[model samples]
Target: MEYILFQKDDFTEKNYIARHEEGSKDDYDITIKGRATISHGGRELTIVNVSVEDVGLYGCRISYFEEHQNQYYHKASQKVFLDVKVPPPEWRSAPILRRYNQVTDTIYDGDIVNLTCRVPGGNPLSQLTWSGCPNGSQTDLSSSTEAVVQLQFVASSSHHGSVCTCTALQKYASPQERSSNVTLLIAHPPTLDIMASPALPWFATGGNATVNATLNCTATGGYPPATLSWVCKENSTQNGTEGPSLLSVFPYVGVDDDKMVCVCEARNSYTAVKGRVFKTIQLDAEYHPQLELTALPGNMIKEHDSVRLMCSGHGNPSNITYRWEHGEWSMAGSNQTILNLNRTDTGNYSCTGASNSSRYGQLITVQYLPITVNYLDVQIAILETNLTEGDNVTLECQTEGVPSLYDFKDWNFQSYLMNDTQLLNGTRGKILHMENINYMESGTYTCVVNNTALVRHGSKLLPILHSPKLHPYRQASQQVVAPVNGNVTLSLYIVANPEPKPADFVWTKVKPDNASRNVSELASSAGLVSNLTIGNVRESDYGEYCCEVANGIGEKLKVCFNVSAQGPPLAPTGLHEIPGRTTAISTQVQWVSAFSGGLTQVFVVEYKDEAGEIWETSASDINDTGEGKNVTHKIDNLTPATAYNIRVKAKNSYNGGSYSVYSDVISIAMKGILFYNLLNENLSL
Candidate 1:
């Protein structure tokens, strides 16, 4: 047998030292070297046969040249203890089992292992056998009085924690059999898998910007357990040690996260050689559909005209479907993208797509203004009746037509004479006002409305009966108030023997220059009463309005009123903390302004610590000049290491109106505290 004490290709020469007893001061005889053969540049020492005399410590000294100093010295040295066995008279001891290296009992899967069982001092060479270990080859290295068996096999995960037993049997001994056992510790890489909370088809519902989910990485079947970790695009890497799984929280998963890949990795002690195992998952998300309704061949639909309305939808899922509805009922059996116009189609049309989101289109009115005179006769309404001679009267004509009568025609008046109607010169507009109407003027009066493409007439009989005393009266002026971007209605009640004509109801606004501008175009009449609506009122709309009435029976009466602008301002928008302006004790907040509601408005800044429920107004009375302008305010006296929620609101000056709704809440943390906490966590890790 050969024993290599020390081997190094770089060494120049090697020396050997032997001692009969380990840890003894006596030096071994140099003559013993003559019986042993040393080869391979003195690296190996071989003896033909080994005996108990070789049981001692052997030391090796080697000399190697140092390139830096250019010198060779016997500086490197190593020593190993050796044991020798011989035949014994009778069996006395159990077998000892150990691996070839005798360094560690742990082995990795797929590794080759060699175990030896030796029994010393046994008569008739006690039989050495291996048990518990399967699929292993055994070799006999027996002497006259000793028994030895070597077992070799490949390690596997199944062999972990299993006991490999070596037994020595002597039929003549008092103790017939003795055994030694060693537990095998096998290491293997783990299998990895990733799981998600609220598992697939992630939907962003409730108009939320992002949907939150949790990802867990699990490792299974590894000795010494496995460490799990996660890697994501939007989140920092996280790890878990010797656990069933590692969790990663995704707080802001949106439609953009679709197909985003996230990785989970697992490793163990054996993973160094086998490499880490990982599993990946691509996010699948479903978001609300974005829809647009468009009309084909033009939106001005006419009766019996063909129309196509397309509902274009975009969303995460590619298989989105659509449905069309008109007014209260679905368009049954109709094309999903088009609807033919009918004479009765005069209401709203809407569209709905997958994701169950609905969108409304503009009001559709089917135009049916034909040139037939019956159309006018069926649609016209006469405003005045019961006329008498020598009495002033006002007549109005109401009709429906496409493009509006005001835009398509200038109302023409005609009178029936000699059993025929002729155009009455100097008579214009939808209303006819006659002064002191006499029997000579009594006849059938007609109101003519026409465009370049069509013409129609609406007429009524004005017969003289008997004369009666008449009086014209006007009501007092009233006060009206509204806010900017709001609507206001100016109403007037009139009483007279003959009611005022629709054209006689005039509205005018007094300007700051003391000049009057006719706003009569905004007026409409239902009977004896007239209403003038001012929509989306502006700053210039605040003033006095006057209504004048003339019936040829009394002096023209004038009614005047003042219109005042007042209301709360609109809510502040785009509230956020101004970056690079926040500190440990103060932070600057910014927002965009909205309408002032026709009154002077001021902004109020409010904030509160995350732990507190009550919000504290940090700054109030911040000056604002106009809408759509960015405004900023600084809040101070804040504590460090604290998180705060901030918001802004607009209030009317002099408490004229209510405060506007609060802006969106924003969160801000003290600058240094975040870095400090992160640094501490890293240090602790």
Candidate 2:
């Protein structure tokens, strides 16, 4: 028989064998069968039932027997080991205990607290429980397997000296447990009492004395905690909160000490316990004696002046006395004191007050005085009534004052004066004098009078006058008037005493006929001379002119001439000639005088022969245009052998005025030089 151990369904085939000697073969018939077994330290281990203690080594073995020998041989097989493994179980420690939080020094009535127990290092389990004996009674609690647990509604004061436990359970180890003892301090929340220092008396004056006070309070024990607040009893004013069992408040002064109380309150939020305490203090009131001094006409006393003084003292019990002292004077009165002062009495003044039986007295002082001026008046006058171009003027100043006096003087025209003398006339007066006066002396002059306490000022100046004149007449050259036919301006040379003076100018025209015509008159403060215009000029207006200047002092005149006309021939318009016998000879001439005039009479045409000799025709009467706009003239019987230069002029009969402009010259070319000889020979034959 043979056997084999294997896991479930591990073996697939089985074989038989016999033991034999080396190199020799002996055949024998043998049967083999496979057997298996599995074991473990605990119950049958399977995947579904795996655990930490079921893990180990596992093995399988095979065995058989030989039958060729007559004697049967027994052989044992090697041992097989089996191992099983399991996973560990989950574990955790219990929660840790926190320090106890106290609410107040004293706990009363309904108070609650939390007690906790914690454990560590455990697998698969822990439980917490609370046990206590308070007020002769025990608290019962059930065992729990939770990591943390809370106890609620613990309003009993009898829960003092309670024990709380935390237990941990492990699969193969002893169960662990942690325990703590809690002492429930049973007390009211806390009672606070506030006390003010220097307690008040029952009866006192209303507002005479100041009251000083301090406040204090205390808090007792409780579970969660308690706080203290100090409040004023009369006004319900909260002062402050304190944490310690005792609190002190800073000292304070009050206007009146009546109806004053301090309240101390304690509160615990964790429990419904509160406590409060209050105290009343009394204070005595008294009126302090006061001394006051008043001078006549108010606080300000004028310098070097006199004043009447009064003193007053006030207190309670109608036993007040007053004493007044100013400089060397002193006096006493039951309720008032009076004093009279002078300049020597200008010193520190004091007043004292006393009660009938008191040892001390109150005092006040007067230290300031008003300001005053003994005299404040100023007078000013010029040193001289008559002033010249380079003469000095002086001003005198005066003022009045007492012991302390001053003098100040200044002049405005100091630049023009050679010697400016400033002198002190008296204790409160001055004198200012200018050494010279000139053209620059025309300004405001001021003199100032001053003292240590006041000032005065005055001013005066001298008036000056002179006459202005214009110079004698000087001739001006003739002028070529502008062709545009506007006013003819002529300037004159003249002089006046005051370089420039207000003057009037008269402009006149002197015609060729030696007659003068006043054209216009102009007035100007500036000495410039100008003439009024003859708007449009004609041949009649071409003549000599004069400008005259005058002032109240004198008058002067200068002469010049204007040669102008409105329109003349721009060029020679009729510049042709007439035919002649045996000679191509003609006259060359120009037209003039586009406008008829008052003295217009004769026209003169001048020319130059081809040999360049100047020649003139006798003055000829020109017929006025039928429309009376212009004049025209003609000349004849000229030799054809000559070329000519020609210009025209117009004249006026009234002034013998001549045209300022000449007509454009015209030049003629002869047909041939022999034509003039032929004309002369033909005429002779």
Candidate 3:
């Protein structure tokens, strides 16, 4: 029998052939390692201990004897192929861990880290996994000879001093696992803080003694310990104390040392790779008080002018009080910072702070304008107000002021109801001479004095002295008429060198029987005029009256007057409208008063719409203008945006008077046009 073998890789033809003769003398080796044997009378083939190299095709051929023709022929059976598979061996060592894309074991925060784990020399690739690296993610990469696992992550302080591990396993192994690990070192910056001991406001003593303050700095949670140092204005750096807590001592702090700052700087390898960290604490050091004094509006003050003196004080632990003094007297109860200065606030002024007794002072000068000197019976250089024609006169001005240096500009003369004109062609002295002064020159003359600080105008009336003269309102032949049960004022004008006092006038009532008596409580005087009021006049009072006046410098004078029966007051005149005081709702009307006919008089203002015929009357309260002065009345509750005619009438208890002439028409617009024009003018200005 012959056996043929073919490799399983290709099945085209036989790769090996062997012949086994029946009972042949030589033994034939048919299979590898002699593990192949033919059994059951050469009908079957079996292989033990199968290996990969035994993979091939096997077949057998048998030759039969031919009786008729003695030739050898072979018959072949079907061919069979063999194949082998081997399981991987168990792991002997742990997986090897290596860092990829990195050269050092330490890394800064936020740096990307890559680590790979590999298992080499495995028939089939083993399964790889990661452990211990909770912050990183893993990826599996396997090859025919090795199993690999790579882990990538961003490093941070939380991952500092952490172990990263990679594990390897096999499927055919009996629950066996091997792991390798590496420790990660993450570097980070530290947190810094600074503080001051014994609080702030470090005080200093008088000599070389002082209250010292300590400064401390601390750095927490860093890979390497941080170094600390102090920096201040006086020094660049100072030596620090031991341990994680750093300290430096500051000695002899003074008021001048206030606002100085101490800086604490912390640095490490991590900070070197990143940035520097530091903290600062400003010093609130203090000492005794120092004061400065100043004044507003200068040290020199004019009379009646205002000034303020300020005392500025500085100190530490500051509770300072100020005191003021002038000359040898202390300003009691004046413990304030500012003192308002006045005329009495002259002489040396000193100030001191309560914390320190040192005083600061300044000299204050007071200046004043010139004042006129007065002599008896002659005020402002004039002795009388009555003058005659062609009288030679001499005027003088005398004044006194401080600082001595002064200038008397000119002498000016102003006539009654006229502008002032300079006399003596702008003279520069206090005395002014005039030849033959007349009644036409009976006006005011002014002397102007100036000291470059202020100007003064001293005036004098030049009317010469004379005897008293009477100028009654009514003519001597005309009689004053008054009504029964009415009041009246007997008024007259007079001129004299000296004004008449209330006691200088006397009045008497003379009846038709020629009886004379002094009327009690009947005389009153104002300025150069006198009045005698009579109430409830009767037929007994309608007779004659005499008024006498006298002054020490003038001869006494007497006048005769008569009183008759009742007659109405005269009508008012000069009906004028005050446009500025008039508004849409009201109008201010003023009129010149006429005679009262020797009795009390009241006014009545009447108005009417210019376009209409209806008239309205308003009775005014009895305001007797004793000297026939202007009387003012207001008309309210009038319609706006309408033209109106207004007039005033004077009435007594009698019934003989009529209304006065009408005023020019006026219109009332919204807020009046004069208000708008005045407001616009002010705005433009």
Best by TM-score: 3
- Stretches of model 3 off by over 4 angstroms after superposition: 1-95, 100-106, 110-112, 122-144, 151-154, 158-183, 201-214, 221-276, 280-302, 305-342, 346-451, 457-685
Q: How many clashes in each structure?
A: 0, 46, 2
**Runs with alpha carbons beyond 4 Å of true place in candidate 2:** 1-184, 187-215, 220-247, 251-503, 510-513, 520-530, 535-540, 551-685
CA deviation > 4 Å runs, candidate 1: 1-106, 119-123, 134-146, 170-178, 191-202, 207-212, 232-236, 256-262, 279-286, 290-319, 324-351, 355-685
Q: Against the unseen true structure, what C-alpha lDDT does each candidate score?
A: 0.65, 0.44, 0.63
Model 1 deviation from native, Cα RMSD in Å: 35.9
Ten-residue region with minimum lDDT total, candidate 1: 365-374
lDDT of 1 by residue, 1-685 (tens): 1122332222333333432222333232364555566555455566556655566566565545667888765544565666664444434557777663324555889998889898777445678778888577878877754677889899998887788888887775667787888888788877777888878756654344444688888777788788887887766678777888888887877766677788887777788777777889988766666566666655556545566666665676644566667656565321343345554554556665553322211112121111111112213344556665666787776766453444213333333224545667766666677877764565667776764323667666666443211212333236566877899888777654355667766677754534333477788875457777888877778888877765554456567767777666779899888879988899998899887765778899989998899999987889995677899899999988689999899998636457999989999997544433644653211
TM-scores, all candidates, are 0.33, 0.23, 0.38
Pairs of colliding residues, candidate 1: none
**Sort order, lDDT high to low:** 1, 3, 2
- How far in Å is the alpha carbon of 541 misplaced in model 3? 39
Between candidates 2 and 3, the TM-score winner: 3
Per-residue lDDT for 337 in model 3? 29
**Model 3 pairs whose backbones collide:** 6-57, 386-464
lDDT of 2 at 522: 27
